[model samples]
Target: MKPPKGIRILLVDDEPHILQFLELGLSSEGFEIKTAPDGASAVEIAPLFKPHVIILDVMMPEMDGFEAIARLKENLSYGAGIIMLTAKDEVENRVRGLTLGADDYMIKPFSFDELLARIQARLRNQFPDLLGEVVHGPFRLDDRRKEITHQDKVLELSPTEYELLKFMVMNHGIVLSKTLILDRVWGYDFGGEENIVEVYVRSLRDKLGDKEHRLIRTLRGVGYRVDLP
Candidate 1:
């Protein structure tokens, strides 16, 4: 049987050549593809296209991947899976991206097979319902619909923000350290700079906007958690 519909994607990169390549590669697999050249444009098109996934480049002018991810989440315009594309394969970068809510991270010069596999993995994790939607407490995340609603109010979130929140909620009540989060979320172990995890947690809290008790909790010496009351 053909793959379910709404597996569409948006690919963001500064280079036209790379965007073209990704469009061609992903399209051949029967995925609908959209492209953007900068973070600003990406944020704009995310809600309009409402893709199921987004592949974002780390290095882009005007706004980097982290800032772009923040903007996306701020607008509540993305609920699709987000995979970060970076040039360097440093563990620190990987951890940082994941902490910011990216579902996966890949270094430059990667094979399309690996990219496709990552996409599949993220989809499976997010949409166990198979209809492309999942509910976590007060949040309703729709992967196929590319939407998120919190207690009736729609939340503006980047691909990364949504993924981060989803991961934390999925593993609620578990105390996850930065290393563990890095490995689980980014598919790597980044020993450098554990503070990046804190940064993302702060971002999540700020966007959540006065949530009581908060979904994310600080573990003192460890990392963080989304706990059940």
Candidate 2:
């Protein structure tokens, strides 16, 4: 097997020391690192940098992480894997990040190993030929393309929705708890606001039409499952 390709990473943080530390650590892990001290800089350099992933700090001057993300979303060429780092770990804040299109989130005072694991997990899922893509009945997913098709109808899913559905389908036939779904899909410790998952679930169901019932099964109080009819 070929060695994993180095993932280009862009680091956005107001803290100089933290940026430097991450630059050094990730670079040592065989990743190309780019540094942006503010959200504006992040926005400016993201397309040119063409990073495969981004480590964005939530709090920054001039343009906060949220605004920078919004700007990045406006440009498809710069839309890369987004992993938010922040001191705020509240359920509402975390949900907000996921809904706003982040691929994952990590709280402050984190371990470097954990961060690396999350990055690898996201990459593995997004490029599942690197891991292994999942298929069930009429559905097929190309994790790298972030594409899904059921009965040949292509799905246009938001980034977060894609992750949620992919996780569920990959673990089909098992009842997943809300906590597990939130942890795996959202990359946070679930804090009892699993309703956020439900909201996305509903959206997925609506898009899937009648096949929703055959594919996504709700367990009520537990979480969800996905399988073919």
Per-candidate RMSD, Å: 12.3, 9.3
Candidate 2 at residue 198, lDDT?
82
Model 2: residues with Cα > 4 Å off, grouped in runs = 1-3, 77-79, 129-229
Q: Weakest 10 consecutive residues, lDDT, candidate 1?
A: 126-135
C-alpha positional error of residue 60 in candidate 1 after TM-score superposition, expressed in Å = 0.4
Global lDDT of model 2: 0.77
Q: What TM-score does model 1 achieve against the real structure?
A: 0.56
Mind giving the per-residue lDDT tens digits that candidate 2 earns over 165-225?
7777655566778887887778764555768988898899998884547679877777677
lDDT of 2 at 20: 90
TM-score of each: 0.56, 0.59
Candidates in order have lDDT scores of 0.74, 0.77
